[model samples]
Target: IMAVPGPSLFTLRDTSQKVVRYHHNRLVASPQTANAPPGGLQISVVPNQFMDPSHFPIIMGINGGTRCLSCGTSAQPTLMLEVSTHHWGVRPRAF
Candidate 1:
């Protein structure tokens, strides 16, 4: 049984994009740190507007700038990962 091809799982564009990293919920398989551009940690596999509305919405991390929450209290397979390491930079502090 060796047939690996259902989109080969996914990791980039097709998967939209992501930078998963975790510690409390469990799911940080090798995330030392290097968010690429504006920093890292992303995870997307979307589409479910009010219980599926036609389609078009799978934005995981969109570059860490989108967490439109309404009420709160709902963690399922709960995996909306995003990370930052390499000493977690922010170059600006000499005090």
Candidate 2:
């Protein structure tokens, strides 16, 4: 699992237009190889308000690349953002 610093309150609108707030200052993502469809990968994000802050780590995970079988070209790699449950108390103040 990879964790990175994130916003204090991640507010997003749900399908019903209600704003959802997550009390987390970090994001965490974990990538697992999908075996059902060969060469498939699945990434999961964690760190909600309910999670304990002390156990989470602060790091980030990035996917390398996927090469095309025929053309020998590689697909662009993606960096996943996984936040930690712990609050760093280093948020930027409004200017």
Candidate 3:
């Protein structure tokens, strides 16, 4: 898991938000193969005030990217946010 340096109140003399705008969590997409399905990627981002159970905090975004917030709340945990992107298309036959 690749982590990006984010803003953290903890950095500011023992506070919270110990990972703001930092983690751009992403997953390496695999190369396409014959008759193979599409691949996907991952990302992370900061958490906004609004909370959506449909998309849990661990993955609070669309099917492509997520933003991790260094700023944490009593409700949200200060963990690295995550997301994924899926690419769909026809699989080519042998060359």
lDDT of 2 by residue, 2-95 (tens): 3546423222334554432212532222222353223222222334332334534222121321210111112553323333324665522212
The alpha-carbon deviation from the true structure for residue 57 of candidate 2, after best TM-score superposition, in angstroms, is 8.2
User: Measured by TM-score, how close is model 3 to the native structure?
Assistant: 0.18
Residue by residue across 22-87, what tens digits does model 1's lDDT show?
346554344334644432334443432322233232324322334421111233333232232225
Candidate 1 TM-score over all chains jointly: 0.20
Residues 7-75, candidate 3, lDDT per residue (tens digit)?
222211113322222225542333445544332222334433234434333323323332332223346
Off by over 4 Å in 3: 1-26, 39-47, 51-79, 82-95
Every model: Cα RMSD to truth: 17.3, 17.6, 17.8
The numbered model that scores best in TM-score is 1
Scanning candidate 3 in windows of ten residues, the lowest lDDT window is 8-17
User: Cα miss at 20, model 2 (Å)?
Assistant: 31
lDDT of 3: 0.32
- Model 1, position 35, has a per-residue lDDT of 44
**In candidate 2, what residue range of length 10 has the lowest lDDT sum?**
65-74
